[model samples]
Structure formats: C-alpha cells, structure tokens
Target chain A: MSLSISYDSSFDGFLSVVFETYRQRLDVGDIVPERPYDSDVTPSVDLFMQPFHVETNADSASRLRRAVVNMAGEDVLNLLETAFRSEERGVEMKILAYLRVLFSKSDPGFARNPTSSEMLPLFLLARAVRHEAGGMLGMVRFNKAPDGSYIAEIEPKYDILEMIVGHFRGRFPNGRWAIVDVKRCYGAFYDGRHTEILDLPDTDTLSRSIAEKAPPDEFTRMWKSYYDTMAIKERLNPRLLRRCLPVRYWKHLHERQQNLAGPASRPTA
Target chain B: MNLQEKLNILGDAAKYDVSCSSSGSSRGAPKGGLGSGCSAGICHTWSADGRCISLLKVLFSNACKYDCAYCINRRSNDIPRATFTPRELIDLTLEFYRRNYIEGLFLSSAVVGSPDATMEKLVYVAKELRTVHRFGGYIHLKAIPGASPRLLYEAGLYADRSSVNVEIPSDRQLQYLAPEKNYESIFRPMNFLAERKLEYSAGKRSRYTPKFLPAGQSTQMIVGASGESDLQILRLSAGFYHQQRMKRVYFSGYIPVNADKRLPALTTKPPLLREHRLYQADWLMRFYHFGHEEILDESNPNLDPDLDPKAMWALRHPEFFPIDLQTADYEMILRVPGIGVKSAQLIVSGRRFCKIRLEQLKKMGVVLKRAKYFIFNPDVPANLRRLYPEMLRPLLIARPKPAQLDFFSQLQAPSLPAPAQLSIAV
Candidate 1:
C-alpha cells in the first residue's frame, strides 16, 4: 500500500508516526511534516499515496526513543536527533528510509554506518546541523540587557537554538543569558538554574539595524579597539578571515559590522 | 591612561604572539562561576589578519627593562606603553568572559621591575579568578622564562596551559637577537613545568592532587628573524613534541616590528609563505607519522617554495607513488597528497561496504586533483600528471609572481651548518 505518513513536524510527533507505521505494518512511500503555523515553503508530499495523519502520542514517542537508544546506542540516537534538528527539507522521507533499515535487524548497526547509502543523506544533514552548532557556540555575542542580564540575537540557517544553549548554561551558570533567533522570534533562555524557550517580540532592531550598530557602550568600544589593533597589517589575508568567520555571520557580530575586517591599516614604521 | 587606552596599548603590544589555542582541557563551570572550559577550542572572532581571537590576549605592562631587537615592547623602542593593575585585569577578564567575548585571558607582559615581580602579578590575577570568583574558563599564563620555579608552579596550579616563547630557532641566534635572554632562561621554566606535569599525571589520583597544566605547554619560534633553515625549525619542533610533550608549536612569520641592525628591514614583509610551508611540515610530523629527518634532510635543507611538504616528499620518493587505495593502510593512505585525516578514515571505513570507486572518493571529500596522481585505482585513468612526478609539480603549483613568493631573496644566508643532531639544549 502506498501510504503517505503525515506528522505534526515535532520530534515526538515524527517518532509517533514511526511507531504507528510499525504497529500497522503499513508500507509508507513518503513522510510529510504538517505544521499548524503557515509556512511558505510547501513540504514534500507523495501524491500517489493515501495520506495518513498520525496524532502525536507522547507514550508512543517515548517507547520508540527508548527502543532506538537501547538497540542502536546513544550516539546513533544523537545522529537521528540531529536529523530532526537539521530541519532539512525532505528529511522526513530520509528518516523513514533510515527507520526501515533500523527496524530490520539485518544490519543492526546500520545507523552508525555513515558510508552506507541509506545513512549518507541523514549523515550529511546531521553534519551541517553539528557544524552550525559548533560555530554558534563561539559566534554568539552577548550584550548586557537593561535588566542586568545578557541578551543576544542570531539568525542561523539551521534550527540550532536549542542545541547551543547547553554550552551557555555550562559557561555562565550563575548569570542570566538569552539567545534569540530573530527569524523565528524565539529564544532559549538560561535563568541561572534552568533553561526555557520563550517568544521574544523585541528583536526588530536586531534585524533592522544590525549593520548600522555603532559602539554605544564602553565594553563594545573596548572590544572594537582590541579587534582593530590586533591584526598585523603585513599579514592581512581576507580569504582566511572569511573562512573562519563567514560573511553570513557578520550581521550580528558588532566588530564585523563595518567594512574594517580586511587589510586597512598601513604598516607603520 | 584609562582602561580603553590601556587595553589598546597592551593588546597591540601583545598582538605578535600567534598561539591562540584553547584546546586539550575541559572544565565545567564551578558552583557559582562565570565561565567554563571546552577541550575543542572555540574562536570567538577572527581579527582582520585572519588570526583567531580565542583569548583576550593582553600584556600586564608594555614597560620593559630589556631590549630585544624583534620585540615591539623592548626598552629601546619609544612606542606608547601602559600597564594594567591586577584588579583591572581581573574585572576585564570576568566581564568579557561573562559576556562571551572571549574564552579566557592570555596575560603576557614585558618585565616591569623583575621577572619575579612580573610573574607574581600574573599569578595573582589567575589565582583570584580561580579561587575567589571560581572562574572555570581556560587560563593560559606565560611562564616567564627566568621566573622562579616556585612562581611557575603556583601559576600552573591555576592555569590550564603555560608557554615560554623561544623567539629564535637556534640558541646562538637568540643570544644575538635578544642578548638579555639566554637558552637556560627559556628552557628552565619549560623543563620545570614539563617535569611537574609528568609527576601530576603519573602519580595516583589522590584528592589532594591539583590539576597542573592540564593542557601542558606550547612554544612559538619566529620563522624569518634568524638565518636558520626550515630543517633547523622542524628539528626543534620535533624535539619539543617528542621530548617535552608539547601540545602545539606555533610559527610566527617574523613581522619586522622593531628595526635594529641585527633585524630585518622595517619595510620587509613577514615571510607568510615560508611560515605556511613550515606549518605544513610541522603537521606532517605531528599527525602523519612523519619524523623530522624524513621531512627535510641535508640534501634538501629548505622546503620547496612551490609544492607542499607532503607533495614534495611524495615526488622525491617514486617508489611510494601509485599507492593502491583499496589495499593501503591508514598511515600510507594519509601520505597521499590530497587525502586528509577525515577522508582517510572514510576510505578505510567506506571500502568495507563496497569496492571504492573514483566518484566515491570524491564524495568522501578527497581532492582528486592531487590524490588522483598518487592513488592507484581501476577507475582512475592514468595521465602524464600521474605518470611523471616532475610533470605533476608544474600542474600542482600555482606560480605566484616571482617577487611576491621570494621572501628568501633577502636572506643572503650564512653557509649551511653540519647536519649532526641539533644539540643546543632544546
């Protein structure tokens, strides 16, 4: 039977779809991520198959999570979670193909085998997710909020806001810090002890005035001064500067705002 | 001067140091702390010169008592100088660290009064960060070469890493450039910290045992300052790796900061290309299981200006060419010019599932432009670039303008020294 499995686009919701597909032993040709909110980019849907909407069941998701963790191991679970976090288009179908391999015990460790054809697409997606997460761990810059807390805004290509907050919690355990995604208008906040996700509405200036942000505060001025005098004029290589801190991330970083990242200073005798 | 002006002066004075690593140690934030350590280093931002701003690198003071010809902060130079109090430095580090501006502090300095006096201030700032504030971030202290062993030990108790810069490659060259400093002063603290680190690691994991230099030590050698060949540089680096267990060896391309009679001309550009080649040779030694002697010998005393060290080594030895990708082990596979650590691991693991093909190699991120010549596979059609190693060199090397690439043109180097093992008390 050519059945199209529709999920609510949440990690648990997608896992329940996997649980239901196995319970009924139905052959799923495609997986569609159904979102309650409007998205301009229409998701992939297999037109030939009858659509099967699976309601998100927490018990079913938990059972499958335990099963995958128990069978394939924790690292493999992380790989699958990264697939969900990646939010790559058509990733649901790739995950469906991956789960089919996982359910069949012919190659019990197929999830770990990145070179295999079945796991390659998921692996590539997971790799992009991980790379951005690592970059965010360093690329995130914080400015002090008026209420004596740290706040920053980022616009990453992937859904990585949740993936990076754990690092901040570890680095700033006693301080309150919040990193918001301006595109989604959502933030992951650390409140000295626990972390929470909340909708942030006051990030309009972040997207609007990012490039025009001058050094208004003393600390920003110090950082800008430090960054300016740090580079040796004789060894300026723009190619390497772009490679380390990419052009896509320049909007948020205050120092990279102006066109002073390249070789500007002449060698003073 | 105010804090901003002081930061600019001290930061500018400390800019020449190229070692920005914050790796090889991991510590979590303390109970009421401001920062934590990550073993995999994170670069907060890159400067205009493409250098990683991993640390808030600054000097305690640029006021010096000794005049080293290559140093910007030397006493002879009349550049604007400033110093930061321990309280000011501590606050700056904590605030910058709390705001995620940097990983930690890289506090180096010129001698204010004496080595002991300067080392005491650096140690005091680090101790306050560790004990009073519970700052768990990566702290890299400069183990002042001539500082007392007790001070170095005290600094190590609170620091994740410490380094003593051997500014010149050979000891004789160092004496000529910076006559106030000697080989004994440079190596004494290094050898002391290395031995103490060994004791901490080898001893029992007792509760009282403090974590001492968890990231160990590293050093930097200026590339173009002295007339030493690439051969000498690689040998010193290899000894540091093998004997002292150094984590990293950085090469600064000797930007002509101060112009003394002994130093390069003020207008002379830094030897960036030679610095790049030396880094490649260093990588071959550290990661590719290559010994320093095997990289550059007495016959070829200098690294080739055109080709990378690995490619040059491959072309020199014809027997090692045309390595069968399917049959070659991991070490030999890594020797192939374009195959990196990641691609080699992929080839080793990927071939188990299917017979490796040309397209699969490209998918695994192998740069077949160079690797195709060295790899022996049925899918790879043989060409002149592969058949003749000499023909391959011209194709691989993109010849930049003659004047731009020739940093050695100004060398007027002294004649080569004997190739007996470098025994200058490294």
Candidate 2:
C-alpha cells in the first residue's frame, strides 16, 4: 500500500511526523507551514499531505539547518532531537529562527555590529527558559517515587526539561531523578544507569506525594533563612519583583522562609 | 546622619544623573576576594517599562557645594541632604548581594564638603568593599571634577569602572548651566586616568598600576537640556570614543526634576526619541565605521524622528546607493541604508563561499526592503538594480514608526541565549 499520512496539527504532530518519516524512510509529501495553508491533493499520483512551510524548511530548509549548525554545531542535530522532544510546535520555528541569526556573524564572519540581530532575540528566549528552569530547579521540592527515583512536577511556558536536566545532571549526576513537565505529561530522566523519556504520573498520583514519606534530608532550613534575610525592607520593590518574577511561577516556588512547601498543604513544610 | 536618612536623600537625589552602566566588564573574583566581576555583560534586568535595575545605584551624598543649574542636588536647593558612612554603605551592599538582589554597585555623588573630602569618602566606600570586605563585584564610581589626582587614582584602584561627568554638551553650555565646573577640572582627570590605564595595561609599572578602572571610563551629557543639537551630541560622543579613550558616552534625556529658570523648560518630555536616535548613531560610529563629521553637520543638528540615522544618511547621500556587494569595500557595505554591521559582514563572508543571491542574502537576514535599493550584488538580477531608486522610495517612506517593541521584548526574559538557538520554546 502507499504511505499513509496522519495529521497531528501541533508541534508534537510535526515532530511525530518527522520521527515517523525518519523511521519509515518515507518520501514525505507536504508538511504544513506555520503561516497560510493551501492544499491540492491528487489521489492518482503519489499522495500529497497538506502543503506548508517551516520557517527553517523555506529556502531548502536553510534556516533550519543553519540554526542547527549555530546552536549544536557538529552536534547540532542533537539539539534538534532535544527540540523535537519539546511538546510544543511553533517553538521549533522560533528556535530555528534564533539559531540561524546567531551563527551568521560569529568568528567565521565576525564583521562587526555587536549589538545587531540575534543578540536580543537569543537573550529573550534563553532567559525565558532559564528563568522557568531556574525557578523549578531551585524550588521543585522533590519527593521519592515508589521506584526510589526523585521526582518533581513543573508547568513552564517554554520547553525547559532539557535545561533542567542540564543543571540537575551537573549537580546530581549520580542520583536517580526525573523532572516531569506535568502539563505536557511526558518527562525525561537519568536513573544513575540510563537516561530516558517516559510518560509522567497523573496529577492525582502526584498530588498524593504530600501524604507519602519525605526524603531524609528534607528541605534545607538555612536556605530559607537566607532567602528571608536577603530582601532589604528599605529597597523592597514588590512592584518590580512581581514584574520580574511573575506570580505564575510563584505556584511552583517554595517559600521555605514561611515553612510552606506544597499548595494548600498548609503552613507545614 | 544615620544610614536610613542618608540612603533616602542620596538615592533620591542621585536618581536623575542616569549614567550607572554594568556593561563591557569581565573580571572575576580575585584570590581571597568575596565577589567577582562579569563585565563581559551585566544582567540589566529591565522593568516591564524597560528601565534596567541590576546595579545598586546610589549617591554618597547630594549636599554639593557647587551650584550647577541643571542639578537638583545643587547646594542652593533646599532639598534634604545626607551622606553614607563607608561601613553603613558596605553593609547594605553585602546584605543585598547575598540575597541575589544586585550584580554590582553604581556609586555617584555631588561634590560635598571639599572636593578632596568628597572624593575621599567615595574612595573609602570602594576601598572598604574591596580591601576590608574583599568584595570583587563590579564597581562603577564617578570621578568628581576638580578632585585631587591622588583621590581619583585611589578610587580607580578599588573600582572596576569610573567616570567624570561632562554634564553639559559643550563648554559654552558648561559656562551657562554649571558655572562651578570647567573643562580643565573635568578633562584633566579624564586625560590622566586614560593615560594611566594605558600605562597599567602596558605593564610598564607592576606595583602601583592599581587596575585604574579596568572597565575604562565613561561620561554622560544631558541631551536636550542644553540647546545643543543632536549633531552636536553625536560629534562629541564620537570625539570622546576616539580621542578620550572613553568606553561609552551615555545620553541622559533632560528631565526637568526641578523647575529652574536657567534650564530650558521642556514643552514636552525630554526628547526620548532624540536620545534613542543618538544612541543608534553612536552604535554606528563605534561599530559601523561611520564618521562623526560624515554622519551629522551644521545643516542638520538633530536626527529625523521619522527615519533611522542610517536611512536618513542614505537619503542624504543618495549618490552612494546601489553599491555592488561583491566589489564594495567592507566599509561601504556598512553604509547601506537597510544593512547593518552584522549583515555587511555576512555579505562579505558569504561571497567567499558562493555568489550571494538576493534570495540567499534574504536567508542571511538582510532587510531587502531597504538594502535592495542600496546594495547591488552580482547574483541579483540587473533589473532589480535598474529600478532600485523607484521601487525603494515607498519602502523608505513606509518605514514603520519606531515603537516600544524592543523595551517590552527585553522584559520578557532576564538574559538572552545565543542567537542561533533562540527558539520560541525558550
């Protein structure tokens, strides 16, 4: 039979198709673009999936490959693989856009214009992901899964699992831990022996972690004391603080200062 | 005065000077040092409205003996005045730093007491933060005009970056607005520090080099407050960069904090757009190979609010348009209206690999809408160049008005990732 095509209609859908195309070695027809869409299907001829363009795929995928080269270089394909692991779709387009501009004027072409292009965009994106990951990285309040694996749940605007793993891998390379992007449901991990991606636990199950036993080390009380003393009452800019560290991220943040850990789990740590 | 009262008066009085920057530094903590410098870039976390707030910027004291008309902290004003002791200021900085609140300190002050005494107090803060506290964090101290050279040198040793304010755009304005200060008091120390920094870097004197402000010196002018035009500011900034060995010339749009008859009462807010344009032109001069005299002149003192400096320059010098990218010198590529330093470099480099097609240049992030009128690459169709002027006029005329987009975008993230991998997924 002729190759069968499925429409996933999301970033993961695009990634799933990409993965499937690589796996099946299929001569994929049309991939939907982020912009406008037009379709002309001729059943008699080879099947034509929806015709679309990726910002990267346009100009023979120059933007995409250039971005991959810029970000991951010889190993840029690895960044592409990690990017695909992201549950979101348009993110890849923006990622590719960001990468292409970054690579254009580095050493090979360091002509001038230090403040021009990619600098602003790259800064905005990296900081957005870094901010989310750093917040979760510092304040996740992990607990032991039945498998003895350390697990923490997070909901972030950007694909930050790779970012989180990068930091955690450095800090806890020997430990078994998994940070689940609870909203997207799929999570990545390093269990001391191997690294893999797996479906995350259901919300109901993660909620039960409160009643479950806690790790012996628990929360560091000194860290909480340090956080409380850091704010200068004289220089406190709650308006500025709220503006920088949005209230959305506050849900995942642990105010160990007040001995509060989980949401509605009360004033108890 | 007590620490709290001092902080209130000094911080409030110093807010309008507008020259505390944490850019172009890279020093890390020294051995036995408590802090490190990350000058390669400082984290300027801007507010939603786009005001950068990473430096613990404050004044040592605002009780100035000099009566500069443009200054709110002038001795003639009846505002509250206070001073920070070395110990109290150092304590505040350490406490704020441990909480991850600020990256460095931007300490400036009006000339309080004698110039020697004021400069000594400022030096003491930096000295304590460095020698006693072992703090290695970035420190930007302002060098007071007419201060003793020894005090200026002492301030330089403990501070990573320092500046002498050239408040007025020109000497004529200096006489008009700030009569107490003159070019000799300001330029003398600046010239000495510049020479000293050169001497230190050359390793001529090993023991007493004293770092001498490793990030280099910067000066600021109050744009629009004085009657100086944009051309005047651009020319001065260019001169400072080239001749003075100054790292940056920060442009502070004149905001009338106090109603003074000597200072021009702005019918509108200090010309922020003009300040923004001056900054863009400054970038071009520093990195884009544009000359000060070449960019502006007596004919046009201010930049066109409707068009960017590059575009306006292009319209002025239309004869320079349609430069063939393949044969154009690197400098000429930088002059093209739509092209920037980055794009110009790309055009030159990409030509090494293959003929640069219009399509290819677009992929390299060329804003063809403007560049098409100015650049003529061999790979581009001849018809594109022949009709360049006619087809390009609309694009130039239809240029989108400058917007608040850049400021808002910066606020969304605290730091930027490398350009190539900046995915929206960030």
Candidate 3:
C-alpha cells in the first residue's frame, strides 16, 4: 500500500515528515507540501490514495537532522541546504527520495555517489544553485548612496541572497550596504557589524528613495564611459557579450542603461 | 584632464595585455579596511569581446619610450596619450571598489623617462593604497623591465601579484621586432621575484611574515608575432612552470595594431584559434598530467586545430586503450578523451559501491561517444573491437553537415551513438 505524506513548505517541515515516516515505518508514496487535496491533487497521484498531514514539530526536525548527519555525514546537510534553495519544483520530494536511499545503505556513504539515480537530481539541483550564487558574486554591481552607504538590487532565479551576503560582508566590512532581491521583496542589509534580511519597501517607494539619494552624477557617467571605451572595436562580438551577461540582467546594470545625460565624453588630444 | 578622459586613453592602451584575473590570494579586510580579496577571483563584468573585466586594468602613463612593433602604444603610433597621478589612481580604485565595479587594480605603465622611474611610480600607487587607504583588495603590478631589484622587491611587498611581459618568445625575435628591448631585461626581474618568493617562504623570519608576490608572477608571450614554432613556445612555457614557479603564462594572439614592417601583414587575422589550442594544451600540462613532449613533440610541432589536445594525444597512443573502467587507475582513466577531472573522480568513487555501467558513466558526466572506443566494459558489444588509431581518426574529426548526415546513416544512426559534441569551435 502506498502512503502519502504532507508537511509545511520548509526544510524543517520536510525533515519532520522524514522523521514520521521512519517512526511509523510507513511506505512513503509521495512527499508534498500541505495543500487542499480536492483543489490541488497532482495528476501523478493515485485517485484512491489519501495523504496524511504531518505537523512541523521542532523536536522531530532536530531529531531527523541529527539522524541524517550521523548516518551520512556533514556534507549531506550542505547538499540538502543547497538543494532546498533551488527554484526547481518537486525538489523537496527529490531530497526525501535521496535520503531514503541513504537511510537504506549500511555505510550511508551512498549519498555522496553522484551517479546513483536517487542522488543525481539532488546533486544537479545543488550544483545549479551554487553556480548561480557564484556567478552573482561577480555580476552584482553596487552604487554609492548619498548617505555614504552602498546599495544594489538583483533579480535572481534562485533564492541566493543569503548565500552571497557573507561574501559582500567580508569584502566590505567597514561600509554599510544593502542588497535587495526585488523579485522576492526582501533585502539583506549589512550595518558594518552583522547582516540581516528585512522586508523591502514597495517598488515605487524604493525607486524614489534611491533616485533621490543616488551618488554624484560624475561617478555613473564615468563608469558608463569606461565600459564603452574598454571594448576593442576590432573584436566586437555581441553574441558573446549576451552569453556572458544575459539581457535579463542588463536592466539593473549602470553601463547597459540608456539615456543618461553626462559630460563623460571621449577625450580628444 | 578629467578622470573619464584619462580612463579612456589608458583603458584602450591596456586592453591587449590580457591578464584580467584577480585570483590566487585570500587576504581578508583589515581592521578598518574597505575590501578583501577572494581566493576564487570574481569578474566584475565581461567586455563586448567576452573577455572578463576582473580588475580595473589601466596604464599609469601611455607616453612610450620604446617602439615595440606589436604594441598599439608604440612611440610612433599617433594615438592620444594620458597619465594618472598616484593620488588620482588611488582615489579611483577606492571609489570603484566601494561601488563593487572591480575587484582591484591591474596597474601597468609605459616607459616614462626611465624604467626605474616608471617602476617607482607604480610602486607608489600600491604603497599608498595599502598604507594610506588600508585597502586589502587584490593588486597586480606590472614590474617594469630593467627596474632595480630594490624597487621590484618593494613592489612585491605591497602587491599580491606582479608580472613582467616577455613580449617576444625568443631573444633573436625580440631584437628583430623590438630593437630597444631584449630577453635579459624581462627575465632578470622574473628570476629575482621567483628567488625572493622562495627565500621569504623558506626563511620564516617572523610570525606574521608578509608574503612576497603571494600570487606569484606571470608573463605573457605574444603568439604568431614572431616566427617561432608552437613546439618552441610550449617548451619555453613548460620551463617557466617548472623552474620559475610561475602562476600563469598568458598567450595573446598577436593583433596587428600597427603597420610596422617587422610585424605579420595586415591581411592576416589574429591567430585566435592557435591561441585557444595553446590554452587547451596548457591546461593538459597543468591539470591533466601531460608533459609538453607528450602534447607537442619534434614529430608534431603544431597542435591539430580540429581536435583538442587530449583527444589528439589519445588518438596517437591507441595502445593505451581500451582501458577498463572498473579496474583502471585514476591517471589512466583521466586519459580518456571525453572524461574530465570531475568525471574521472566520480567514476573512481562510484565504482567502490558497484561496477559503473555505461549509463552510469553518462550520468556521472562522461561523454560516451568519444570515450566508448577508448574505454572497455561489459556493456560494450563484442563486435566493437578496438580499431587502429588511423582508422578511428576519420570518425572523430568533425565533418560538414551533408557528409555528417550520410556518415551517420551509413553507421546506423539509431544503433550507434553520435560523436562527441565539439565544445570549442576551430
């Protein structure tokens, strides 16, 4: 008989479901986020099978965390964290299926096997998330605010704000900075001491504030001029530029923006 | 002149140098510093040509004293010239760093008055950045040729990396193309920095000893400018890697920037494909454990532009294959055409649990089409006996579309796997 398990939409909630599955020795058919069965039943689900709602108790979540770490290793926890941050649908279920294989193994080192069917999806998803986060470390551009603070905004595919904050914090320890995820409506603010996530104001309010407190006109103008002058005229390849810096990201870039009046013209000798 | 104008003239002059990486150092921010260095370098942006813009690469001054034929900023070239004061450079770097526009500065300069005077000016900018600004960001200074050893050593203490360009590969060509420069002016400083790095690391003089050239030194050799063969260039690069402990050896395909008689004619395009092959061959030597002789020997001086160096090496040594996936060592497994370092490790790790099958190899990131003939396993059919190297060469070489379709149909498209997808265009 197949069993369906549902839980709150979170990493801890998924771990809670895993703990309950082991405790009851239930044969898990599918692990999904808690939703009204009649309205949101997936086509893949059997018509007869009913899912049992699992409460997200902190005790069970911690217990499952310890069990997985003890059985597999510390690396599995990192893999799960990265996979959980991925935007791919059904990543929760994939992680559960991967852990089920790890729990079945005598050594539990099977979680590290990238070629295994159960672990491959989780590994690929984790790699994708990590790759995006790494790319953002370079592509993220900040502008100086009037208050002597730095501010930048990003629209990333994955939830990578928390993953990349530590890098900026380490690099800019003395300065106050804010990196907002406009799509997610949240921002990570570092106050020269610690970083914390805060709900960002609405777009209208944020844009006005940023416009009012922007850096001197000279900095932006000079930067755009440098970007234009740096490209070699003989080796111009727009295809390669688009490949590296996708058009989607050009919205927030200072150099890619259009219609900025400035005195930063090419110097004539 | 204003900063924007200075930036244009200097940035244009610096574009051809081609070492934009800010990697190999992991210095953290100081007590009240504004920036830190990441070990895995970050590229702030990519130029239109797809080259990374990691550092704010700019020349300190573009008023040249030497007329190198391949250089755009040669003394005879009619180009706008500019120079940046030490204060202006430091302020620009800090402001850019604060805005996260660049990782750090890649400061080079043309000969201003003398090599020593130019070297002193470059060192002053770095010194003020570290002392006055407390900047911990990555700094790569260009060590001027013929500079005093004292200036080079002082520059090393402040800069994370330093480089001196050996524009021409050989001394004879160096004399022919750039009559004012020779190999001794370049190699002397490189040898000095390499020796000083050894002494600093070995002496362990202080508990908090500062690193001298922490990212080590690198040199760029202009390819296709001189008439030197690929074999000679690769041999020289290998010697640098082994003896000098150089961090990187950059290959800049010669761009015909001037109408000099010594340079290759303007009709020829830059040998970018040859430069790409050299980089691939360099990677093989560095990471894949292949020697320079193994990659390009006296027998074959130039690399096959159609195939990668690894595939070329594998095609020549047919006797080494078909290697067994289950039992072959890591080094042997790495020699397979399509298997990279990551996939080779995955195969070794996966086999510990169970014998890796062909499908598992594919999932583990191995490209099976190129590796199938080279590797042997239980899943491979008995009729698929290893053929002679020459017989297999034609199959691996990428053909045009119409011919490729005919070849695919003749080989039974559904039954046999397709060839490896060529990642780099020749």
- Best candidate, DockQ: 1
Clashes of 1: 0
Predicted candidate 3 versus true structure: per-residue lDDT over B328-369, tens digit per residue: 999999899989998898788878767788887887778887
Docking class of 2: incorrect
Model 3 ranges off by over 4 Å: A1-8, A23-55, A106-109, A201-217, A259-269, B204-207, B383-385, B401-426
Q: lDDT by residue for model 2 over A2-54, one digit each (tens)?
A: 34344433444544444445445665444433321112222333344444332
TM-score of 3: 0.90
- Runs with alpha carbons beyond 4 Å of true place in candidate 2: A1-269, B1-8, B31-34, B203-210, B266-268, B354-364, B377-395, B398-426
Q: Please provide TM-scores, in order, for all candidate models, with all chains considered together.
A: 0.89, 0.65, 0.90
Colliding pairs, model 3: none
Candidate 3 residue-wise lDDT, A1-269, digit = tens: 77777777567888888888888888887777643312334446666667688889899998888877887778888888888887456787788787777777755457666767777777778888998898898777777776778888787888898999999988888889999877666799999888989977665566556555664367777777788778876667788888888777776667776645321222221
What TM-score number comes out for model 2? 0.65
Q: Which lDDT value does model 2 have at B373? A: 70
DockQ of each: 0.58, 0.04, 0.56
Q: Return the candidate ranking by TM-score, descending.
A: 3, 1, 2
Model 1 complex DockQ against the native: 0.58
Per-residue lDDT over B1-426 for candidate 2, one digit per residue giving the tens place of the 0 to 100 score: 655556656666666655656666655455554445654444433322334445677888777788888788887888887777777788877644433345678888878778888888888888888888777677888888888889888887888789988988889779878878787788998988888888778846654445667889999888877788888788778888977799989887777766778777735466677888888888888888888877788988778787788887877776876788878899988888777776777677656544567765675667887787777776656776655444555667765768766887788876967666776556
With candidate 2 superimposed using the best TM-score fit, by how many Å does residue B273's alpha carbon deviate from the native?
2.1
Reference-based lDDT, residue B394, model 1: 85
Shift of residue B244 alpha carbon in model 3, Å: 1.0
